[model samples]
Target: MRRTILSSILVMLAGFAHAQTPECDRLCSRDFMFSLDSGLDVMPLVADGEHANGHMEDGRTPLIWAALDPDDEDAIVFTSTLLFAGGDVFAQDSKRGMTPLHWHLFRVGGPMKEVVAMYLGEGASVISKDNFGYSVLDIVNGVATAELYEVYELPYVNDEVADMIRGWAELEERWKDAFGMHLGRDPTSVRYFEVLAEEGYIPAMYAYASVLEKPKVEGFTPDIEQALYWYEEAASVGEVNSIFHVGSSAYSGTDTIEQNDAMAHEWLSLGARHGDTNSQSLLGLMYANGKGVERDIQKGLMWMIISLRFGEDTPDRVRLIDEMSSALSYQEVKEAEQMAKDCIINFFEHC
Candidate 1:
C-alpha cells in the first residue's frame, strides 16, 4: 500500500511538470480570438518568451510577430490585445534592435499601413531610438510614405515629443523631393532639392547635381556650366556620386568647360580613394587608354581589376572584366577575384 501511494504521487508530479513545460508556447499558439479574450492571462506567457508570436519565432513575443504579418486580421487583433495588455510595443528584437513600428513603417504599401496607424492611435511610441540612434521615422523617412508625418502628429504633447515629430515631418518632405527624381516625375523637383540643399541636407545637394548633369530636352543645348556648379556644390559637401560625376565631366569636355584630363584624373583619384566604384572604373579606363597619363600595362591591369571588384557585375562590368582579364596572366586574375570575394564578405559581416 505504501509503495503504491509513492508511485501515484510521482506520476502526478511528472504530469504537472509536463503541463508547465509549454505554457508559453501554448499561449502563443492559441487562436487570435482566444488570445484577445484571455488578455492578461496570455500576457504573462508572452512576457516569458516561451512561444511564437506574430513576428517573433522560436522565442519572440506576439507583438514582434504581429508587426511582420500586418495583413493578417488575426495578427492585427493579437497586436491590439498585446498593446492594450501593456505589452512593450517599442521593444526591440535581440539581434537587430528593430521595434514593431520600424517593421510596420517599412511595409507601408500594404495592410501594415493601417496597422501602423492603429498602433499610433493607441499611443505606440514612434520616437523610440534604435541602436544606431535612428528613430522609426528616420528609417522610413527617405524610403516610403510621406504620409507618415500626418499620421504621427499628436496634439498637446510635450516639447520633446513635439520636436521629434516635427523633425520627422521635415525629413519626410525632403525625401519626397528626392524620390520624385527617381520616379522621373519632373525637373521641377530640382527646385525643392535646392531648398533642402540650402538647409544642409547633403543628399539633396547630390540629387540637384544629378538633375543638372542631364539636358532638359534632346538637343545639344547642354547646361554644362550649371551642371558643373551643382556638381561642385555637391562635391564640396563630400557626396561620393557627385565627386565621380564632376571628375568625369572635367575629363570629358562638355560644351562649356574645356576638357582637362589632368583635372579629371585628380577628381577621379579622389573618388576612387573614397571607394566610389564608378570613379574607380573610369580611372581604370583612363589608365588603360593612356589618355591623360603615361601608359603602364601592369598599373592599368591592377586598376581595372580593382574597379571590377567594386563595380556592379552587370553585363557591362562582366564584359569589361573579361576583356581586361585577357591582358593579365592567369595568376593575377585569380588573386584579384579572391580579393573581391574577401571584400564582399567583410562588407556584409560588418553591415
Candidate 2:
C-alpha cells in the first residue's frame, strides 16, 4: 500500500506544480478516474478537481471511486467539488447498472456521512433499482435499512453480502487483541481495527462503537451517540449481534438514543427471523399491547409461545401468556400454538 502511494507521489512530483499541469497529460491520460485506493492526491492534476469526472476501466466515475474509500478526506472534498460542478448523483454506469451509492454501500472505507449526505440530500434515491431489480438495501439483504424504514428497508438476503459478513466475523476473531490493547497493548492491533472501522467494516464498526460506549482506557470519555452510530453501521450490514443491540437498546432507551418503538420493531423483526427468541418475546408482548405495531392478540400469543419453546418462559412471560389465553377462544389458542410450532420448525419461516 505504501509503495503504491509512493509511486503515485513520484509520478505526480515529476510534473510542474502549476495551477494545471500537462504532467498528467502523459502520466494520467491513460486513466481519467482516480480512487481513494489509488493512494495519491490527484487533486492537483484535475482542473479544479470538480471537472475531474472521468470513468475508469469498469466505467465507474470519479464519484463512484471516491465512495469506496474510508480514509482519504481529500477524496470526499474532491467529490464535493465534482458535485458542485454539475456531477450527477444518479449517474449509472452500464457495468452492473450501479450508481455511486452502490459503491459506497458495498465497499469498506472513511468519512462515510459526508459522501452519503451529498448524494442523498441532492435527491439520490435509495430506492433506485439496479439491473437485477435490487435496491441498495436489497443488495445487502436489508441490513442497514433502519434509516430508510419510512421508505422501508430491504429484507431479501444477498449471498455475497452474507459471505462478506462471515469473513468480517473471522477477521474480528483475529483482532480480539485490538479491543483494549492500547499502549500496554498491541498498537498495530489497534490500528487494524481503526482502519477497518473507518473503511465501514461492520464488525469493526460494532467493536469500535462498543469501545466508545465506555472507553476501556482511563481518561477517555464515553460517547453513546458515537456508539449507537457505529452499531447502526454494523446493523445495516446484517450483523446478528448488532441487530440485537440495535433493537433492544433503542427500545430500552438510553442517553445515546431516544426510545423509538418503530425503529426497535424493525430491527427486532430482523432479529426474530434469525431465531432470536428474546426478540420474539418482545414482539409477542408488543403485539399484544400495540406498542410499535398494531395490536394482534394472535401474533402476540404466537410469538410468546415461540419464546417458551426457546427456554424463555419466565414468570412474567408465562403470566402474559395465561392472560392472553383467557381472552382467546380455545380455537384461537390452538391456532396460535400451531403458528408457534410452524415458526420454530422453520426458524420463523413465513413469520
Candidate 3:
C-alpha cells in the first residue's frame, strides 16, 4: 500500500510538471506587458477570461498592447493566439470601447494590413462601435494611407464598409490638398492616387482614370486611351463604378472607340446583377426603349421598379419611375410596386 501511494504521488508530480512546461505557458510572463520586442511564444496561453500572465494592468489584454505597436511580431503572434483562444477581439478597455481592430488600424503603419486581415478572418466585427459610436471602418477610413486602402479591399468586410473605403480612395486627392498645405507640403500636385493605385487600390485606379479623362490645358489634351486603360484596371478588380464607366464609354464612342450598344448592355447587365442601382436604372431604360435587349415592357418595368427601390434620394430617378409606372396598366403597376416593397423588406430583414 505504501509503494502504491508513492507511485501515485510521483504520477501527480509528473502531470503537474508537464502542464506547466515552457510550451504550455508560452505567453506566461511578468515583463511581456511593457516590452513589445519580447519574442515570447504565445500559442500556449489559452484565453479563458483569466489574464494569462497576470498582464492586465487596468483590464487591458495583451492583444490591446500588440495592436498599439503595429510592427511587433511577438505582439501580433500573441494577439493572434489570444483571438484563436476566444479572446474578445471587440473587447473595450476601461477608458473607451475601442476594439483591438480600431487600435491596429489607427496606430499601425503599412504592415498593419495583415494584422487587420487576421483579426477580421477570425470573426472580429468591423461594425463594433466605440464609445463615440464610431466603428472600425470609421477609424480606418479616417487614416489617409495607401496601406489603409489595401486593407479595405479585403473581401471579409461588408459592402457598406467597402463603399466607404472606395469613396475615400476617390476623394483622397481632395483630402490631401485640403490638409497638405497645413503640413507644409505642395497641395495641388500630390501623387496620392498614384501611390494608392500602385498599392492595388481599385477606387484610386478609377479616380486616376477620371483625372486622365478630364479636359486639359490648351497645350495638352486629355489622354482618353489612358483613362480607358485605368478604368479597365479598376474593373478587373471588381469595382462596380469602373464597370459602369467602361460600359458607358463604349456606348458613347469615347476614346476613339466605336459605339457598341450590345457590349454596353452586357456590362451594364453585369453590374446590375451585382447590385448596382445605377446600372439597374440604365439597363431598365435600355430595355424600355428596346435599345439593347428585346423591348419587353414587363421586364423593363420590373428592372425599373427594383432600381427605384434601392436607389438613393434622386428626384430624377423617382420622377422617371413614376412616369414609367403611368404607362403601365393599374394592375401591372400595383404588382410591380408591391414587389419592390417586398424586396426592400426582405433585403433589410435578411441582411
Candidate 4:
C-alpha cells in the first residue's frame, strides 16, 4: 500500500512539473526572442510574473541562460531583444547580489567582450560587490590560466588575451572616466563601442555615431552611411534620444539621407509617443507647419505643450506657442489640452 502511495505521489509530482512547464519554458527559453517576436504577449510575463528578472530562488533570467548556453548563436541579438522587451539588466541576484554583467564577466572572451561592453553601456556596474563581496576586478584580475580559459570554453584565444581580459577592468575604468560616465567626447577610448553597438547597445550606437560624426580631417573619413546606420539601429530599440536623432536627421535631408516626409513623420511620431521631449517638440512644429505631416495646428500645439512639460522653456518655443494660440480658438485649445492629458493618463499605450 505504501509503495502504491509513493507511486501515486511521484506521478502527481511529475504532473505538476509538466503543468508548470509552459510559462517557465516560454520565458526562460534560450530562444525566447523567437517566441516573443512571434506574437507572444509580453504583458503576462511582466504583469504578475517575475520571469524576466527571475527571483532570488532561481537567480536566472533569459540573459543568464543565453549567456551560459554554448549552442545559442547570435545570443547578443536575443539579449538585446530581452532589454527591448523589458528584461531588467540591472537585476541583482537576491542571494548572490551578482548581475548579468557579473555572469558575462565571469566568462570573458569570444562574444563576451562585446556582450559585457553592451551591458556596461546600458549602465551595468563594473565594480559592484557580489555575495562574497568580490568584484570582477578582484576575482579575475591576473588569474587567466589555460585551465581558466578552457573552463569558459575559450581555448582558441592566446595567452596575450589574459592581459587583455585582466586589464579590461582598468580600460573600462578609463573609458568611463574619459566620458564622466556618459557618452560624449574621448572618442579614442572604448574602441569596442562599435562592436558593442552592433551587439545591440543603444548608447553605444549613439556613441559610435558620435565617434563617426566627430570633426576629423585625417586617418578616418566620416561615413554618413555608417552614422545613419547606427542612428537607425539605436532607434530600433526605442531609445528616445536615438529616435529623435534619427527622426530629426531623416526629416532634414542632406547629402546623406534623401528627405522622406512620410518616414520622418513615422519616426518622429514614434519618438513622440515614446515620450521624448525633443521628438515631441519637433513633432509639434512638424504638425504645425505640415512639414512632414498634414497641417493640424491644434495637434501640433498638443505635442508642443507636452514637450514643454519636460523641457526647458525656450524663446522659439514660446513664440511658436503664442502663434499657435492666436491661430486656435479657445474650444480647440481646450480640446487639445484635454487630449494631451488623456495621452499621459493612458501611459502612451493609446497615445
Find the candidate with the highest lDDT and give its number. Answer: 2
State the TM-score for model 2.
0.45
lDDT of 4: 0.53
Tell me the number of clashing residue pairs for each predicted model: 6, 5, 0, 0
Judged by TM-score, which candidate is best? Answer: 4
lDDT of 4 by residue, 127-213 (tens): 566665666555445333434323543223334433544455554554455455334434354456666566554556777776665
The predicted structure with the larger TM-score, 1 or 4, is 4
Q: Can you give the TM-score per candidate against the true fold? A: 0.44, 0.45, 0.44, 0.49
- List, residue by residue over 1-351, the lDDT tens digit for candidate 2: 000000011112222122122234433442545443442244333322222245556565544554333344554554443432234556775666667666555433312555554554343545567665665645555544434322233333346544543454445444555654653644354456667777655557766776677566555567777777777777665455667777776677766567899988988887767555566667677787787888998888887665553232345555667888778899998888777656654446697
Candidate 4, TM-score vs. the true structure? 0.49
Which 10-residue window of candidate 3 scores lowest in summed lDDT? Answer: 2-11
After superposition, candidate 1 runs with Cα above 4 Å error: 1-135, 138-169, 175-191, 210-226, 256-258, 330-351
> Please, what is the whole-model Cα lDDT of each candidate in the order they appear?
0.50, 0.55, 0.50, 0.53
Candidate 3: which stretches are off by over 4 Å?
Answer: 1-192, 215-221, 251-258, 313-316, 330-351
The weakest ten consecutive residues by lDDT in model 1 span 2-11
Query: Candidate 3's residue-wise lDDT over 223-304, tens digit each?
Result: 7888778877776654667777767655566654557899888777766554455666677777767876798555566666
